[model samples]
Target: MKTLFSLFIALLFSMVAMAKDTDTRYYEMRIYYCHPGKLPDLLTRFRNHTTKIFERHGMTNVGYWVPVDNKDNALYYVLSYPSKEARDASWKAFGSDPEWKTVATESEKNGKIVAKVVSVFMNLTDFSPAVKAQAKNPERVFELRTYTAAPDKLNDLLSRFRNHTFKLFKKHGMTNVAYWTTIEKDGAQPKLVYILAHKSEEAGKASFEAFRKDMKWVKARDESEKNGKLTEKVESMYMTPTDFSTIK
Candidate 1:
């Protein structure tokens, strides 16, 4: 009986260790505009108002982007936290804050700032190795990718990329990851947005080499490509989170 109990404790420890290996916190937002041409105005407002509102409430801005080239017309951003509870509570308070309400209302006087928005919550999978203890600090090198897919191909593309490639990435030390797709809505083009965290630009450059060489990812990507058109187009950008000066 003692031996059996020892085995059970050992198994539990293994599971806990594996969980820590991939533990990461991520938050995603999709900001859909009333018109594509209005992006410049909206971005200015976001930089001036929205980011400050979030910071006051405890959210750490991870990265932000506008569509440089893509079918989807939206401004997507990512934020990170120590846990989901904090994310939920912070947003809840921010939403009700008088300051945020006033700013959001005032920003749209010229025109509608956002026609719609979507929020998604996710955690990194168990295979991802932890980032160095230091990368947990607020400032780090990161990039955001928004891969827009045709409605018909959305599910298949998600299954391949999210379930397959993402898992493989975690095993290769791509930790503290965040990924999500926009909720289906009229005029809303579906997109998969994810943030990649790295210690430096050089680290980001080198880390992907491992993922690129993964045999399973290569085969799966090729298979998806051959099966049919999985993506109409992909829009990706490398961006750093805004600093105090940029936000100001």
Candidate 2:
């Protein structure tokens, strides 16, 4: 009996350790729309100074990219934090850093570099692979997909991805970078956003073709929508890493 109790205690401790290791981390996805002809200045700031300042405040610079197919001058990047509290604290510190203030002041001496900024705070889904699990292929293309769920069907959409869609994606050779749902106050509630990596644009096309034809995925998607469609619309964009990006 004593031996059995010892084994139970050991198992409990093991579970606790695993839970701690897998603690949820928060992510911030920021999109910057550059002022006319100012994209270079914005990129220079991030490459030479902003990224280092972010690190000083405990923010993990995940990756930075510019859309391959976007006509507008836009930049997208991801940052990781241990928790929402940590994210808030770090941003507060980063905003107040004298160096950052100096950089911003000097960089925009002529005019503002950015015309608009959009930020979304996200929490990773339960099944998302770690950020470090990204593929090492330098030419890999990252596809960011944003889905707007039908009213009241957000949970249903998340369930389908959690249980069926992600597995099928992996089976078709797609690398799941990260999955996230925006925090409510960010304004786009009932939305699912995720990034996938592919060897190339042609590979991405082929993978999605196979993924859509997968019988399991078809059945799962159909069944989930019997009551009503899960997603109303999906927006997708292909992005390539900037030369100075941390992840590529």
Candidate 3:
């Protein structure tokens, strides 16, 4: 019996090791700014073809969304890869796929679908909750927030989020989706980007108001800024998941 128990313990350890090996994933956030009056065409292409092609090349589709306000004619999506090396290879293959080439050429026969493409590579922060595609609540409203840190203050900003802000956010009924720092190779600014899920737009506003008024948060923000402000500006957008979005 002791020997059997010992074997079971070794097997458990092996399984744990394997799980850890596969836990580190890299993500890419892509914003495709479609040409005026061509937003539907861009979304159609992804819904009908691009996402399948991505899966064929081993990319995991995390989510796809369109901003509720629609001010920029943009589509936002996230893709996950097993590793940075895997991401690079997958993209190279995806771009070279014959089906993709045909689809892109046909989609652009009238006019170019996209005006600009902004891509950011990101690694999940230590404190980020695991985001599962199947677990997302369809009724939840997702808020994407980007914070541009003041020069040389990116670390301070991260520290605040890691140590204080996230906790306060939860206390006020915010659901942390995921957090990431832009990859250096992507030439992204010194910024922190994260998504939060709220029960509704009204709930989102109420949560922020409560969070801002919390004494702990007020104290933390004041103390952190004693040296200098950590962020220069913050951009926020509320998004709704598309019908085919994996997360929604």
Candidate 4:
């Protein structure tokens, strides 16, 4: 029993390390909730100054978007760093930069621009494509999806997506942008988050409806869940790229 327990410990750490892979780039997703009627000011600041400061601090700006409904007055964006340590360092520098401080103060002169902020750090999955900026496209809509894995079933969930779901999504007219798993500090539970692009919100919904009915997907999902369901919950949001977004 002692030997068996030791092997189990080793395997658990191995899996965690494989998922984190701190040596590689680490990504952060941030949502800024602006004060009512203050969102436009926040966007202007980011467009004119914040993005440049981020680049100066060695952060890679991935994409920025706002929800179609705008019900939450939130701005969502993703940033990447060379490594976990680099991410921390860059954020520290960004917070203290004189220009950033000035810009923040200026943007909020009328009133506090942001009411709240949420951030989640993540590691890119092996199956994720390299995220890159695209030429501006006014017609594209992006969907962000989050899936929570069932207890001790994270591997099974990842395997299913790796082996099957990714392909089916593209086949159904979805463009796989990137896939990530939240770092333990940010994700108390095992979870997967990914982005997909479609021609429009209508197109995105239609793609998923078709994807669900595909026999190949139905078979793969059933086979992967022989032990039990792989996910506990799923959340999806449709967003349009901001005019200044790099991924637009």
Using TM-score as the measure, the top candidate is 2
Clashing pairs in 1: 128-170
How far residue 244's Cα lies from its native spot in candidate 4, in Å, is 1.3
Model 4 root-mean-square deviation = 7.0
| Stretches of model 4 off by over 4 angstroms after superposition | 1-23
Please report, in order, the local distance difference test score of every candidate based on alpha carbons.
Answer: 0.64, 0.89, 0.90, 0.91
TM-score of each: 0.50, 0.90, 0.85, 0.88
Q: Name the better of 1 and 2 by lDDT.
A: 2
lDDT tens digits by residue: candidate 1, 72-161: 557666565677788889889989999878887887777775667766554443333342223354556556666778657877887786
Instruction: Give the per-residue lDDT digits (tens) of candidate 3, residues 1-248.
Output: 99999999999999998678544798899999998999999989999999999999999999998999998999999999989899999999999999999999999999999999999888777778776775457888889999889988888888899999999999999988889887875555656889998988889999999999999999999998999899999999999888889876
Ranking by TM-score: 2, 4, 3, 1
C-alpha-based local distance difference test score of model 2: 0.89
lDDT of 2 by residue, 63-145 (tens): 89899886789999999999988999999999999999999999999999999999988887777777762438779888999
Q: Once model 1 is optimally superposed onto the true structure by TM-score, how far is the C-alpha of residue 10 displaced, in angstroms? A: 10
Each prediction's total of clashing residue pairs, residues at least 3 apart in sequence or on different chains, is 1, 0, 0, 0
- Judged by lDDT, which candidate is best? 4
Task: Please report how far candidate 3 places residue 210 from its true position, in Å.
Answer: 0.8
State the local distance difference test value for candidate 3. 0.90
Considering only N, C-alpha and C atoms within 3 Å, which residue pairs clash in candidate 4? none
Model 2 ranges with Cα > 4 A deviation:
1-7, 133-135, 186-189
